[model samples]
Target chain A: MLGDNDGILSGAHFLDGDHACAEGAIAAGCNFVAGYPITPSTEVVERLAWRFPGTGGTFIQMEDEIASSIAIQGAVWAGAKAMTVSSGPGISLMLEHIGLAAMTEVPCVFVNVQRGGPSTGLPTLPAQADMMQARWGSHGDYEVIALVPNSPQECFDLIIHAFNLSEQYRVPVLFMMDEVIGHMTEKVVVPPRDQIKITPRRYTKLPPGEYEPYRAGDDLVPDFAKAGDGHRFHITGLTHNEKGYPVMNAECQEQLVCRLVDKIRTNVEQISFFHEDGLEDADVVVITYGISSRVTMRAIREARKKGVKVGHLRLVVVWPFPEEYIRRLAKQIEAFVVPEINLGQVVLEVERCAAGTCDVISIQHAGGAVHKPRTIYDAIVEAVR
Target chain B: MSMTPAVENPVEQLLRSERMPHIWCPGCGIGTTVNCFARAVEECVSDLDNLIIVSGIGCTGRVAGYLELDSFHTTHGRAIPFATGLKLANPKLKVVVYSGDGDLIAIGGNHFIHAARRNADITVICVNNFNYAMTGGQIGPTTPLDAVGTTSPYGVCERPFNLPFLAESCGAVYVARWTAYHVRQMTRAMCEALNKRGFSFVEVITPCPTLYERRNRLGSGLDRMQWFKENSVIKNGVDTRECDIALRQKIVCGKFVDVDRPSLLEMVEAKMASVLHRRRWERMSREQQKPIAMRPMKG
Candidate 1:
């Protein structure tokens, strides 16, 4: 099925979307993957389990989501680019560790192939309800990078990008996918090892005595050292100084908290990635992400053919909000329509980024159903009128 | 800030400067528990560089931060899973986990049973101090039924967990328990668990000085240690059924289960070997080593 297009197949055959993500991780130099079998996302771990051994990587089906999440963190700390994939209920169990990774600034990838949930609402269905939770789930204030993909090909590309951004920023980059994209079957051309960019976390070659684990120079990201690299340094969830020792004082807490939040917020422009179309003469812009964006794109094109001035903005990087693109569009567009499968997750973000320039509205549907193109097309037509 | 005292043995040095001054309070049993871990590592693991220590959030969770080997101070109730990952990633590395009562039994209960069922090659050192120490002595899963704590002002109503019994029932290869007062025995137990090749669990009945002491009116560290010494009985070939009854009434301390089982690493290697053998028929010799060709991208 995988006929060559623009690159060497890298011995990667055309598989389902889940297998593409697994192969993408391997191409990104991931040496370890841990997961528990939750539907929709289970195939991700299964494929990794079958392929990793041949690739000289390790795969483990952990007992639950909590263990699977932590195991990946441990492997990453041991100097491997590691990952874990899970669904809604499992992702709920992993939130605490996700916050820990944010606090400790561990470079790891969390692939959340989302299913409908207030609590396991639809185990095998698709919903983007976790868009807000992925950004601000854990307690306390911190910045995390999350990327959404609209297709099986983007799933492969974005997974590699997620690992790269995680290593480059020293933050846990989340790969957000709904069940639709995660389970979809499509042909993806995976480039060879040389062409695919691999970014490992920065390692300190200095002696063990001189290495400071959490030394935030100017980047606010800590210097990481792997276990067998012979560097000995402490890492804790408690507020600590640059050397990674625990500091119980409030001043240390404030300094650490401020820097952690500011690092990603300040560098959001470089961190945010998305695409915009037909903005110059568009009356209404449809803002969407993940698999929902695919439907919205179709709706926008359909409305445009009917003499409506419709445009589309698909977010590849969901967190960091794509504020600059939205701000630039705010001056030209009359109405911003956000169509999501959740109640009101990303619309709030669009509204805030709009900054009172236009009428920001949401076309929302919940409980495991797709956002049909007609509903979104009607919203675009009304907004254009 | 002063320099730590020196000791001759590396294990002793590990206990002194490497593991202490611990974050535990003056009379807390966590320090002694960590001391035993240091001794165990020195005795069992020949290469300290190959040792990986993983811990969860709590007073007892701080054990990883003090260890001489590479350690991970993870989130609450997730230490076992983290250690599971560390071991599977590199089967050459020896992984051990240290977690508190609340961390392992309550929040991490799912991981605990699952790790046991999978039979991963990891040693778990669970310090049961009877209450949540770092969280200001809340009633924990290991807290005695009538025990007083910050949350259990009128005494804890729920039944406490029998940790060793749970480990044994869930198929841990080695299951043992020792109080902090029995330092030598605890260290020996830890060393034995570390040496065993499958999922091992060692529960140490540690003392909580700050909140646990104030609420229970245990008076001091000496009084609690004395109580543990008098009440708990050390036995061999202990059954999980009998242990649960003892847990209801008294403290049960013993080497409950020690049997061999196939570890997760062993199973993975076997599977890989089979798959590799199937592909061996089409293998090429070392003489042929040509670089493959690639296609160009449009972008």
Candidate 2:
């Protein structure tokens, strides 16, 4: 019953991890949510179903991950900020369509609250196994924005950021959260409607006579024409010119591919959102994200207290990764400690970004549990000191 | 009294003429499927504003290239998911997914079953050309067993998928099969399916002229049409057992199932009601959480 007129301090209450995510997405101005219930992420849909309508939005429980992903894509095309949350199996099912969204340059959000498995490994359990898949899950070399969230508040804030990035780049943004953060109940403060920043769809508010769907300019993002806008525009996953027509020529294919890739790559600075702590004169930097980052942060704090020179760099955006920052830190640091729920995913990114400057170490785990601060603390002490 | 000036059709009148019709080959079954779709569009609720046509990569997928509506031609076998997105985005739109046999059953098989299971409100018009006509007649999932094609040099070992049966099994509310020769029946089936409430599938067993016919010695496109006309039998009433027998003998080509299921959007909204209610009840007495001094943001 919260209204736009109600000038109330709408803050966070103690809720399960998934519900917090739902609330976060709602507050982030997500107007459409399409998903199927899978473990670790089901509560997200459950929370969204109720919250979406009151905001004059829609929530759809699609037949499967494929349908859910498609529905979200459609909702976004209609000029609404839309999202879908899923897990491992669901993500696998959506890989093909995710590629389509990428190729079509459709702005949408896909939340993969990771669960264990190549196929339905552990529905109720937590695992970060989809980290690699999130970046390279879909076939082909395409640029995708993936954000990793560690806590309930982040679940809310980054969803808004995710929506903004999707709109800005006109590409699907993957919000990769693990089952732990998805299920962990935490108190989060949602800002007032006026206080919260929102990115509306980049629409062509022109007369029907002057509309070109894939009209290119300095910005690779197409001018979106929502369904009710009366503008006739074509959208397809084919290799097309700026006019959105299927072009069979190699030159056209090259141009289209470059635009799709360059749109994200060139805008890396705008996409980068991270937190750095105690990097000055520190020998070891704890590089982590998602649920693992939370533990790594605590471990950094504990190690610092013990006079071990260890810092933490928590990445909010996992794709179009903060390579420059990591590269800069690599020169100063002796070792980069990357702790993740999976065996080793982001470590490779850190290693590549860091190159041979620092010893990139992976503190990995993949049983339905969070990496303890002690495990991270041991890595820091062993690597740096 | 003046008639309610028809909602001033805000969108451009999706003129069929906008689609210059010469692209398709002469005597092509794709033209028929496209015609059925065009006619079905008229039969569908006349909210052209919300009507979206999604097609996949195929000769039939080219349907989107010519259609004068809100159209999307997605990747191979990915039209179902793409249309699912469009349908979920705005439930107001009457979404129709047009794809070929290879596009629908082979690459897009997962999306197909799931869309049916979800009972997504989108209508799927699968033109079963049996062969991958666009890519030089590769053996598709719906390619008949022992049938010859470009990839299957000698013969195909895999049995063709019973598309209607598969749709019904996957939980589609309305499922039907018709050959290209069954022009009236196919168009009518498409119209009814388009007008239906939940996930509806109309599988048109269309002929492939260039590769499929040439390789299989099915003569010309006209000859293939005659084969369909002579082979297919219309069954108005029948049990599952009898239908299966007829299908096995390649005789029956009719609407197999028509039943309502909880559409994806409806089910989602209902579940959303409960989640929202529970959230409201809990949030009534409490406050939302403020951001911490330092933590990673979750999206």
Candidate 3:
């Protein structure tokens, strides 16, 4: 039976992305999950419910997304690797707690299975419209790590990475999975527990009375202490001091919100990850992420056959924006083409990072489905023009 | 704190006195209730670190902020779910949800019944001041019928919820009620709730001196307390259905429900443990065999 130690399947399985994501979290030592079932995301919790008992984990079907979001944070503070999963409408309701998670610096994970939305736009349908929301959905000046997975295997791999990054930064890492990746079934090979490396929660070594919950060292990230661990501290949604007590003053607000944003921003090099193909000598580059990257791959290959010197840059970590790489690449590339399931979301980031150094072309899709190869091929053709 | 300190500081030890004197209004029952809560914790638990207080948004939600223990002042209408996570994640910790009627029952009512129905192992201290006290005396879920509120200036038209009935029907293992004036009883109830093993609820009718009391012309907080002393009846183990409070009417307060039912965690682990063990054994057997499988798929 799985204990506090090992629960990894350590074998290849033909699993849907949602199931693979669940195994990834379990393998990453996630033992507490509170979630509400929303389409394209329910399978993750369903599997956890089936697996948590002997696996030394807990799965709760909360009242709603708001409760689910805060519940995971509660679990996180109680010293469990915790997570919650939902699609667009549910994600909307969770926004407030997500902000609270940011404010309190609670290390947790949120899986957003991207669906078309203004409000419940399409439950089972695919969309990348939530890309911007993943960064700014919560009201406040805060940043979170967001990862996009294209296949079931990447879903397995990246969810673990998301947990690691979350623990390392003490931020709620957003696992931004689109409907296609979430519902897609493919082979995912989860390695042995010993082979997998995880970022354990950095518990404070300071004695109980000496410990301060929000006090950080030079890394700008503080170690955590669980509620019952004899470290008496307070956590609140309001702006707080280093001792974790709410202080409603401008100085405290500046001190707190700055660290929340800078913790991720300064460590962008450590957190930012992407896959680059044929970029060293290319004139035009095609950038994509999530399922959109897989769709754009066909267009890139087709464009290559026609002698277009267009390269591919697929983002595994979508925010902290990967600004440095985009800026540096923008200096050399003649143009950049971005195609996503949304009308246009990440393209705005690409254009912003490109900073008019080169032309940035956007291929828009309405998001009920993936883009046609011909359309992306045509966008690539136009970007290099 | 005042320029002149009070003769006796009952909550000095448990309250974050540096962050205080709290925002509770003059002659408010909230401060008195908080004092009782602190005293209850002091009596119940030898070790204070394991006690966690979580509160939602509102005047009563501010209770978590004043407590010196490990506390979480969470989002409005979310204290119970958050405490549910806290308790399940670490069973050793004693989790408590403290919030107001508006925050817990009006917007957050669904979670209240569900948590009680699931019999989540946590104590809930719901402070009912009759109206939405924080938002300036708006009609609330527990607002007595025909009472005056800012939003219901002509007197409230709707029937109020009998919180004890709601809690009892939803499967709480222990349920009780007391007015803020009943300090000793309220403190004892909290102590009992802290010791209870399953979902326990204690409803305290406190005076919202600035809002509920003033709008209803209930005179001062002192007057409200005096009225409670006159009108309240202690009916321990009474039928919850008849305990509802009405305007200028008899206020029935008591321990309404105390029974046995497995908590959500207990029920889940009990049902799933054996099946989970079989699967774990199967995984172990698989590990005893060939190499871990590997495959590559379309990307």
Which model, 1 or 3, shows the larger lDDT? 3
**Maximum-DockQ candidate:** 3
Model number with the top lDDT = 3
Q: Which candidate model has the greater lDDT, 2 or 3?
A: 3
- What lDDT tens digits, residue by residue, belong to model 2 across residues A1-385? 5445232227657776677667767766777788898887888888767555556567767657776777677677766788888888988988987898899888888988888886879888888888788888887779999998888878877877888888888898998988888878778887877877877778876677677787766877777788645565667777877656677898988888888899888888888988888878899989888888777877888888889988888888889887887888899989999888888988999999888988988998875888899999999999975
lDDT of 1 by residue, A204-316 (tens): 76788788887777877766887655565667887878777778899999998898888898888889898888877888888888888888877888887898988788889
Q: Please provide, for model 1 over B41-148, each residue's C-alpha lDDT reduced to its tens digit, 9 standing for 90 to 100.
A: 666666666677888888888887776667778787888887887676566677788888899999989889988988888899998888888888899887877888
Q: What lDDT, from 0 to 1, does candidate 3 have?
A: 0.87
Chain A TM-score values, per prediction: 0.95, 0.95, 0.98
Listed per prediction, chain B TM-scores read 0.86, 0.83, 0.89
Error of 3 at B83 (Å): 0.5
Candidates in descending TM-score order: 3, 1, 2
**lDDT (0 to 1) per candidate:** 0.80, 0.77, 0.87
lDDT of 1 at B150: 83
- In candidate 3, what are the lDDT values of residues A254-274, reduced to their tens digit? 998999999899999989899
Supply candidate 1's per-residue lDDT for A207: 85
Superposed model 3: Cα runs more than 4 Å off: A1-5, B1-11, B273-299
- Candidate 3 lDDT over B1-299, as tens digits, reads 55975587766789888787788888788888888988887777766777889999989999998888898899889899999998888776778999999999988898899999899989999999998777777998899988999899999889999999999998999999999889988888888887777899999998887888888888898999999999999999899998989988889987778788888766765666456557664564343222112121112
lDDT string for model 2 (B41-156, tens) is: 65554556566788888798888777777788877777887677666656666778888888888888988898888787788898887788877888888777778877889888
lDDT of 1 at B264: 76
